[model samples]
Target: MKQNYIYIILFISFIFVTLYIYSSEIKEPLEDYDETKNPKLVFNGHWSGLFCNINRLVNFLVLYPNTREIDFNVLASKTHHKPFIGENIEIFSKLFQKYKEDIPIDTTYNYDGLDFTKFDLTHRKAYEYYNENRYKLEPYNKAFNKYLHLLPHLQERLDKMVNEMRSDCQQVIGVFVRSNALADEQPTGIMPTREEYLEAISKLDTFSKKTKYFLRIDNEEDYEFYKSKLSPIYETNIKRAKSNKGDAPHASGEYLSLEDLENTYLEIALLSHCDILVHCVSNMASAALYMNMNLVSICVSKPAAQ
Candidate 1:
């Protein structure tokens, strides 16, 4: 009886190992597309989720070539909106069903099994448009609205700065201070003095006397002059962003290049990771409001350029 029991145990162990090996060989489906096999579909809706959402949809089309249907209509003006919602999903579904002869995707994508919240357009005219076209616009709008709610919950949603970069042995805090570049350059206004900057920093010192702070600035030379007075633990390259190439309207007469704009985005992401933000009346301050941080945020509202 003992020998028979040992044989049965060994057989069960061998079966389990074989199944594990077989499962390991089964690769996960990658998210990718071959534009040729599945033709490209123009994405018409609000472009916010255009790049990311379309990219994923294309991958689905490629994976299930026979079942996935392409709809260029969603990319049309009739469908796309500044804030996408629900009706768009139904339209997309109908288009897909036309080609596949069956519904391959769920009419609604339940987020973590929870029903998504409806979109609330702050702009009255836009809200009216959505209501009038509810059958055509609801789904896409709902998806985007759901995304807005989920954004604040991400762990690394606010880009990491000093806190995220700190080594296991060292600890630091990253700080972002901003003002409208155009505001100071206007003929009527003047840049604040080093004394003013120091005074503001001193006020914030009550939060942490020992926290190391890294200063980020758009104008490298301007910040250099204040470095000694401000006593920042570290400072990022101002013109370092100039190495990359692209352009955005700049108040300083010259436009910011692609590299410059991208660097600014990265810098903000890191700054938002900080425990606190000391802002002046600048767009960067507006960005901090969007980022949900755990620390107390003390923002100094700067007057708009007169």
Candidate 2:
């Protein structure tokens, strides 16, 4: 009876050790296998602006290399006010050519069992991810160049605008001013004052009578102000906020038609063609940088603003 009792205890101990090893080692590998084999990221359209959304998409592709596919259907459903169906498809078709048929705006499909990582578009979180993987981000510029391509018609329009500017000016300096209610939307003193922008532009090597300024300001007041200060300013006929009191025309309750969004993108693309860009830290600036990696940028905003 004593020997039998000892044998029973040993058997129980063996079983417990086996279970512990399986839980600690075998189970984790199985989960990792699932993640690596079919990793999917979902975008829920958390951001408002067009470039903000584009930046989020670019961040995901750069940060997560194992991402086999992404679901923009959720983004499409959430962004009814700013419809991203056609433009979003056009953008992603270049990135994921193999999965073209899989990319559609379907909100009803069940994604229950498939484990997915949701992309959060907040600036702080994005920066944190960028810092954590800074060493591996050498491909960031390459990724942007590979993925972000303007539509053919838009590209043609941008070329024509550049040619027109070149005809009149020895150097085309792009100036992006985030004036008006963006200050209210962002932190205090984040937006550079009029004096600061003027000072930055004045310091540029190409600042001369022969240099033309390409303005991308949010409100008409700044538009007129810069046009007065920097003569021969060229701007597209896109909508601008009438006053400094309200949100930007696009961000305000005003309906942003497809043309408005395309014009916004066109402005950014045009900025890429400039000899130098003087701006603050905004999505527009970042998008322009992505479009032209070698474009010289002079940020007049405070360093903390970034």
Estimate TM-scores for all models: 0.39, 0.66
Residues 242-290, candidate 2, lDDT per residue (tens digit)?
7555556655544555566677777887887887888766666766765
* Candidate 1 lDDT tens digits, 1-306: 999999999999999999876544322222222323433233333332222233233333333343333343443122332122233332232222223233344221111101111222211212122212323323333332222221222324323334444433232344444333434421234444445556666766544344655565544444555565544355454353221121112332343343443344446545645555554433343333233334334433322344
lDDT of each: 0.37, 0.59
Worst 10 residues of 2 by lDDT: 107-116
Compute the lDDT of residue 46 as modeled in candidate 2: 36
Off by over 4 Å in 2: 1-43, 65-138, 184-189, 207-209
Off by over 4 Å in 1: 1-180, 184-193, 206-209, 238-259, 301-306
lDDT of candidate 1 at residue 200, scale 0 to 100: 60
Positional deviation of residue 264's Cα in model 1 after best superposition, in angstroms: 1.6
